[model samples]
Target: MRMVFRWYGEGNDTVTLRQIKQIPGVEGIVWALHDVPAGEEWPMDKIAAYKELADTYGLHLEVVESVNVHEDIKLGLPTRERYIDNYKKTIEKLASVGVKVVCYNFMPVFDWVRTDMHKELADGSTALFLEKAKIEAMDPRELVRAIAGNPDFTMPGWEPERLARLSELFDAYREVTEDDLRDNLRYFLEQIIPTAERCGIRMAIHPDDPPYSVFGLPRVVKHAADLRAILGFADSTANGITLCSGSLGVRQGNDIPAMAREFAGRIPFAHLRNVRVYENGDFIETSHRAEDGTVDMCGIVQALHETGFGGYARPDHGRHIWEEQCRPGYGLYDRALGIMYLWGIWDSLGRGKQTKREAFSV
Candidate 1:
């Protein structure tokens, strides 16, 4: 398992690439051009600039978190073809800089939703919380306000540009169903997978945040079967899943470790964060450690090791600790701590060198 850190970008993030490089065992940063809107051709010069930045600290530039899919593409709109052309261009640009994996998601409207950004935990350290009652009863606009409350830090999924027209987006998607979303995703994969394979890039789609539908939105990437259906869309090594534990772990029924071993061959990127699931189907993102949340992070790592998942894995969202004020979930202190926790598991179980490509490939 190659450890990675998710850095927003220079100036946009409180944590710097320099600080990230100092973290032990972190081989790269999961990054993207946050300023760029989805489906636009990422300038080669801009891609080169970040690649150069990572090279300065001996970090690899290949493991970027997301290149978001436009709602048009997700809806199978006529304009989607234009956006797809642009996406193909962006993939080629990333290839020019040696990016191996690009993690993107197909969730409509809000990428991920939380009832509260800083739900107070018993330990005093706050975490990104989602209560069952709150999610089922509370308004999405309220959640939106809380997530974007910090004007300084732009939430990656909840972008101001796309979400500002919430009402319209909701109205448009109101008619769309889960099956519609799945069909559109299949359409997207058919077009993009070929381009991705040609560029030597793997497209790892992140599971829906919380691994469920929210605000009445249709979500297709929710469970193991969903992932299995998604991978079977293109039937290529370039099409895969990001396999985030915290997102899928919100539902108690998900067997994260088993899914890792089952999909090991296709999982090129992994988001290793844990969340404590309440009995009522709600959850809160906690530190990477086992005790902090319900997700069996150590067992997940053991499965990764057992399956020889020699790919990029990074600590996902973490709680805010030490009174440190930054992005709601992307704080530095706890995430760095999360990295070491992942390291502890990997060091004990991550025996032998990184596995070669052919080992897990079918």
Candidate 2:
């Protein structure tokens, strides 16, 4: 597994590239042009500039977290063709700078949903938490105020410009269903996978956060069958999925390790993090250690190793540790710690395989 770190950019993030360079085993940055609006082509000069900056820190610019799919595309509006064309252009531009995987999601309105950004844990370190009851009871506009209200950092999915039309977007998605969303995604993959294949870049779709319907919005990429159906949309390796542990782990049904082994060849990116689920259906992000959360971190890594996964993975989210006043889940301290834990599991698995091979040889 090739480990990478997600860096927002120069001024937009509190964590610096210098700090990211100090993290052992991290070889690249999972990045994107955050300032670029959805459905627009990314500026070529800005893409080159990002590559240049990462080069200064000895980090490869190979994986992009998202080139966000526009709501028009997800909604299957007539304007979607224009956005899809622009997405193809962005893929070619990213390919020019050596990007190997582009991670995007088809979740409508909100990309991911959480009730509390800093829900305090029993250990006093805070992490991103989702309260099911709260989510079901609260208005989405209230969520917008709670999440996007932060002036310090822009949340990935809750962009101010987009959520500004929350009511309208919600109305637009009201008529759309799960099957409709799947068809729209199929159309999108059909349009863009050819370009991605030509550019030697895999297009990875991130699973819906929480892997369930939220605020009555339809979620299509939520389970193993959903993943299988998505891969069937395009027969090329360029059509892929980002296996996010924390997102799918909240639901009790998803067997993450088995999914990893099953989707071995198709997954080009992974977001490996842990979340502790409660009897009440809420969850909180935890350290990457298996004991700390419900997700089988070690088992997932072992499966990846067994499958010989040569893809990019990142320590998805971290707790607010050491009183680090940073972005809700993008803090540096805990993420670095999470990286070490993941490495510990991966290296031990590697050593075990080597020992077994040596014993057989002897």
Candidate 3:
């Protein structure tokens, strides 16, 4: 498992590349041109510029968190073809700069939903939390306001430009169903997989945040079966899944460790974070330690190690710690701590495997 950090470019992020370089075992950054809107082609010069920045920090630019799919592509609108062409061009541009995997999602209007960005935990450190009951009762507009309430920074998934037209987007998805979303995703894969294969880039789709339909919006990439179906859309290795633990772990019965082993070769990217699930179906992101959250993070890492995973992995959302004020979930302190935890598991597993081989040799 190659460790990477998620850095939102130069001025946009509070965490600097210098700080990221200090984190042990982190070799790369999962990044994107956040300023560019979906469906727009990324500028080639700008892509080269990003590479230059990473080079200065001695970090590899091997993975991109997202190249968001246009709503037209997800809704299967007639204009989708034009947007697809734009996507193909972007893929080629990214490939030109040595990007191996491109991580994206097909979730409609909202990407990840949370009731509170700084929900205080028992330990006094705050983290992103989701209360299903609150979502079911509150209006999406109110939810958007709450999520975007941190006016100082821009949330990756809940972009104000997109959420500003929430009512229209909701009306558009009203007639769309789960089956429709699946078909559209298949169509999207079919169009882009060929280009990705030729460019030597893997297209990994992130599972729906929470792994369930929100406010009647259809979610297709939720479970193991859904992952198999998505992989079946294109037989090539280029089509794949991101296999995010926190997103899929929100719901019970995901069997994250098993899924990690099952989809071994196909997963080119992973978002490793933990979320504690309550008996009442609520969840809150927590430390990456296995005991901290419901997700068995150590087991998941061991599975990846056994599979010989040679892909980019990053510590996903982390709690607000040490009073370090930054993006809601993208703070530095906790994520660096999470990296150390993952490394501990990985190195111990490696040593154990070596011991077994050495014992047999003697």
Candidate 4:
């Protein structure tokens, strides 16, 4: 596994490249232009600016976290063709920059849903939490307010324009069953996978956050079977999944390590992290360490190592560790800790020569 860190551009992220370089085993950054709205062509100049920054630190810009799919595409609106054209152009632009993997998601309005952002954990650190029971009973207006209340950070799934009419969005999606969603995704991949393959970039689709249907909206990429079905839609290496443990592991019965081994041939990228699941379907993000969280980080890493996961991997969401007043889950302290934990496991597998500490020393 080639280790990477997620840096939200220059001024966008509180974590700096200098600080990211301090993390052991990290050789690159999982980056993107967060300000660029979905379906718009990514400017080559903007991509190059980040490339120069990474070059300065001797790091590669090999993976991008997301190139968000527009809602029109998912809804199968009349304007979808236009958006898909834009997405194809964006893919071409990204490929020109030598980016090997593009991680994107197809979930509706909210990419991922969390009941509370500051849910306190046993380790005295706070993290994103999902109380399943509460979500089931939540009113749409209240849900909108909870999501919008946090003006300090822009929530990935809850875009301002979409959230403005939650009811309309929800109503429009009521007819979009699982099968319809899958068909739409298939249509999308049929059009774009060829470009991705030609450009030598693998398109890894992120699993729905929380891995379930929310607010009566259908979510197609919720489980392993869902991923399998979607991958089969376009039998190209370019069409792949961005296997995130925290997202897929939240649902009971998803063997995350097994996914790494079974989908090894197709998977080009992964997000490694853990979430502690509780009774009544509730779960909270935890340290990426295996022992601390529900997911088996060690076994998963070993599986990837055994499968020869040559694609990019990065530490996913992290807790608010050590009084770091940073973005709720994007704090440097816990994610740095996560990178060390991941490296320790990957190193123990015997393929690695240098310890993370030594490897990180530029």
Q: Highest lDDT: which candidate?
A: 2
Model 1, 1-362: lDDT tens digits are: 88888898888898988888778778798889988887788888888889888999888888877888988998878999999999998998898889999999999988888887888888898988878777888777787787877778888888888878878888889899999999999999999999999999999999988677777889998899999999999999999999899998887588999999899899999899988887777788877889878989988999998998989988889899999888888888899999898888877774576734332212
The candidate, 3 or 4, that scores higher on lDDT is 3
Of the candidates numbered 1 and 3, which has the greater TM-score value? 3
User: How well is each residue in 1-362 modelled by candidate 2, as lDDT tens digits?
Assistant: 88999999999999999999888889899998888999999999999999999999889999998999999999999999999999999999999999999999999999999999999998899999999999999999999999999999989988778998999999999999999999999999999999999999999999999899999999998999999999999999999999999998998899999999999999999999999999999999998889999999989998999999989999999999999999899999999999999988888877735432221211
Candidate 2: where is the Cα deviation over 4 Å? 352-362
Model 2, residue 280: what's the lDDT?
97
Provide the overall lDDT of each model, using Cα atoms, as 2-decimal numbers: 0.87, 0.94, 0.91, 0.86
What lDDT score goes with residue 43 in model 1? Answer: 81
Compute the lDDT for candidate 1: 0.87
Query: What TM-score does prediction 2 earn?
Result: 0.97
Task: Report model 3's TM-score to 2 decimal places.
Answer: 0.96
Tell me the number of clashing residue pairs for each predicted model. 0, 0, 0, 1
Model 4 scores a C-alpha lDDT of 0.86
Candidate 1 at residue 48, lDDT? 88
lDDT for 16 (candidate 2): 95
Query: Model 1, clash count?
Result: 0
**Local accuracy of candidate 4 as per-residue lDDT tens digits, 252-284:** 899999999989978898899999999788999
Better of 1 and 2 by lDDT: 2
